[model samples]
Target: MIYVTGERVQAYQVRSAFFDTRWRGLDPAQVHDYLCRVADEMDRLHRELTTARTESERVRQALRQWQSRHNGCRRRGHDD
Candidate 1:
């Protein structure tokens, strides 16, 4: 019962979708292929997101350390 709203759609949502069959309905094989591709792309994007978040956290920590050091130096009257 996963509906694709305007917001973000997860891979599982895409996989769980089913189309009702009737006269002159859309091809099922094509739908399956497209869904597979979309799911694969979503998985790849998830991995990239995880990597980017980790990198961002590392950079944030590094910047905080640098700022702390700089502030300590200024408090000691050391200009650099």
Candidate 2:
């Protein structure tokens, strides 16, 4: 799995984390459940990141096109 952020790494760490038991550490089952939830949240964030990157690239392309046209018009001394 591609972990884009520290949180994703932390989530897996939590899932696999072992606690030294003097009496007993936190319940493994509960920890696993929480880790599952964190993983789900990370998945959502990753999807959002992908979408934002795609949108940013599209805007960059559009801006480049506009600049090209503007530069051409300026060269021809056209105000419009």
Q: Compare the candidates by TM-score and give the number of the best one.
A: 1
Model 1, 1-80: lDDT tens digits are 65557878889878777888889988998998899899989999999999999999999999999998899888889997
Candidate 2, residues 32-67, lDDT tens digits: the string is 788788777877787899899999999999999989
Question: Which window of ten consecutive residues has the lowest lDDT sum in model 1?
Answer: 1-10
- The Cα local distance difference test for each model comes to 0.88, 0.74
* Candidate 2 Cα misplacement greater than 4 A, ranges: 1-22
Clashes of each: 0, 0
Q: What lDDT would candidate 2 get against the real structure?
A: 0.74
Highest lDDT: give the candidate number.
1
Error of 2 at 64 (Å): 0.3
Q: List TM-scores for all candidates, in order.
A: 0.82, 0.70
